[model samples]
Target: MHSLINRIMPSASGAHLFAVVALAGLFIWFGLMNLAGLTEATVERWLQPHPLAYLVTPYKTWLPYALGAIQLFAGVMIAIYAVPQRWKRVSYGLIGAISIASLSLMFTNPVWIESLGGFPAIGSGQGLIKYVAILGVALWFLGTKGANEIMLIGLILVLGWIGAMKFTGPEAEGVWPLLTGSPVFNWWLTDFGKQMASNIIGVVELITVILLTGHWWNRKAYEVGLLISAATFVVTLSFLLTFPQSWSGGFPNLSGTGHFLLKDAVLLAATFILYRD
Candidate 1:
């Protein structure tokens, strides 16, 4: 199995390039969402529950927008960081800023314990907690020379397990709002109703897992899996635009649902790694 994986995986340089592009895309996409007020709920949710929430309460009106602009700038810098020898250092600075901003959420978010199921149990907070791994990946990409196959395996397990859960009654019901709001998925709800629509999505995700894991055995299957995985994230990420309620506190406070979907940013990045490898 190890030999087969090595044979199928992309060359080290190719994988590294793919990872950079994927990370840049995520930063840009997420930054735009913040600047456009699409992720206002998320920003608010993260800030309002922090121990120092009162300190920033006075600047609440404009803080999110300012942060959004920073995000956008950092993403652009990261994208072009390697273009010129001088710009490389600037890019590292931007990456540091972005990393600090994201990792700081660990201290600010209240749901870290209960919603994420504490330490032993992985629950809804899995979305937020996964940022730790993302941070590590960023560090690895910046400092290391080789691919981290373990990260790819981690993504497969998380996505596959979550995809499988979608078939269950509770899981199906959980995604109803997202399905109803999504233009791509809304039709499923209209045509098949909630349960079946959820089941359909489940099947798609399961198939994605098969394709991802099958890369060791079938190159064609891996290519198809990458396509499906990209499409899935595109559809899921669109929920930020379609669902107004995803922003629980009007513009910036993310409700439970919004928080749940925000993690797709990391998942989207992971997809790129899998696609190349």
Candidate 2:
């Protein structure tokens, strides 16, 4: 099979160019948004349910500016081949640091879906999960061979763990709101029953994991697994459009459910790289 870069990119250097442009562009977009205060409200909402609620005011006021500056510099440093090696290292380090810090927020933030009795219901914490993939993006840009695997691991863990959770009651109920919002998925609830429908999805996800794992023996299996994984993200992202309740304060302001779906974008990117590589 032809390497995707060969078919789509002009040359081997195109791979590096792709990473630099995509990753740096994402950071640059985020930096500009944060700097413009467009994300301030969203940031404030995320902090509200945290134990450090007292820090919300101070944090919201300054975090956007600080993160914006860091992101802008990091984006520039990574994108410019002529940038000093020292600055590139600093940019990579900053990306790693911020990614780790954001991932840590999952533990500290309120994650419970109160109506479903919390624990496995996963709320605001879902928003932070993509930092894992972002960290992988950083590693890739920094020339790590394991970067692709890092992202694959992210997809596997998300599917494997959440797939397991689908067997439980709270999880089934927790996803009910999202499932009902979609005309395509709603039939599953009515026809198969809630738990059964969730179980079906869980089975598919687990099978995809199995396929990804078994790829060592059958390249075809690996290839299929990546496609399935990519499809999974595409479906979830569709929820952002199908589910009206996805938004807390309209378009740009996302609710917990919105965050959950949006994070799948990064997971989708994970599958894309795995397939490309």
Candidate 3:
């Protein structure tokens, strides 16, 4: 098994380089997008319905630009080597902070479809959940001693939370748009009922949770879980190509759904890190 994995997998350094470059690019791209005011309209809308709309409304005009500057700075600082190592760590912390802030918005925005009984049936919440991965990436790159185990734990938490959501009726209905827009997964709805399709996904996700949890006790289970986890991220990220709703306006300007799927790239990167020997 070790021989097979080595033959199939890229070197750890190569994978690490890819993740750093890819995430840096994303940060830069999003920063530029914000600076261009491309997403100003979206931010405007987000502020309006927010619980603290009054306080945010005042800063609405300049907020996007500020966001752009922060993201751009973080991206640039992390991508280049001229800066001190501490600065790179700061950039990673910035990205992680940004991710945490984004996740906090899920509360203001309500991830659980309240109409569908709200606890676990995440609808619009999918957009924010991958922030977990974003945080994981930051931690991973920071090279903290236990960051590898931390990332594994993070993955398990997210997979368990989101996977459990799939079992509920609301989540089954919630994925309708993604499934309908997705060419590969659309068949799941056609071949099996909505609930059943969701159930299948739920079961598989739960199995991964079990497998990954067995990482400490069983090496084989850990490796198998990593493979499955990798496949799961790869497929989800593929939605960018297969789903029409993935993009809006043009390539850089993604729709809400597109943004939701975009974070999977980093999540996939975390899985790569986990595969390291």
Who wins the lDDT comparison? 3
Note the residue pairs that clash in candidate 3.
none
Residues 20-57 of candidate 3 have per-residue lDDT tens digits of: 87688778978988999888987776556567778767
Candidate 1, residues 48-88, lDDT tens digits: the string is 77777798889887777777776666567767744664454
Question: Candidate 3 has what TM-score?
Answer: 0.86
User: Candidate 2, residues 109-226: lDDT per residue as tens digits?
Assistant: 6766677677776655555666777688677657788887777777777787778778878777777777877876886564788888888888999999988875467776776787
Give the per-residue Cα lDDT of candidate 3 at 196.
83
A best-first ranking of the candidates according to their lDDT comes to 3, 2, 1
lDDT of 3: 0.79
Query: Candidate 1, which segments miss by more than 4 Å at Cα?
Result: 1-122, 129-140, 143-148, 251-256, 273-277
Candidate maximizing TM-score: 3
- Scored by CA lDDT, what does every candidate get? 0.63, 0.72, 0.79
- Cα-based RMSD of candidate 2: 4.7
Runs in model 3 deviating more than 4 A are 44-57, 81-86, 174-189
Clashing pairs in 1: 40-252, 41-252, 41-253, 41-254, 116-125
Candidate 2 off by > 4 Å: 1-60, 68-93, 106-124, 188-190, 215-217
If both were scored by TM-score, which would come out higher, candidate 1 or candidate 2? 2
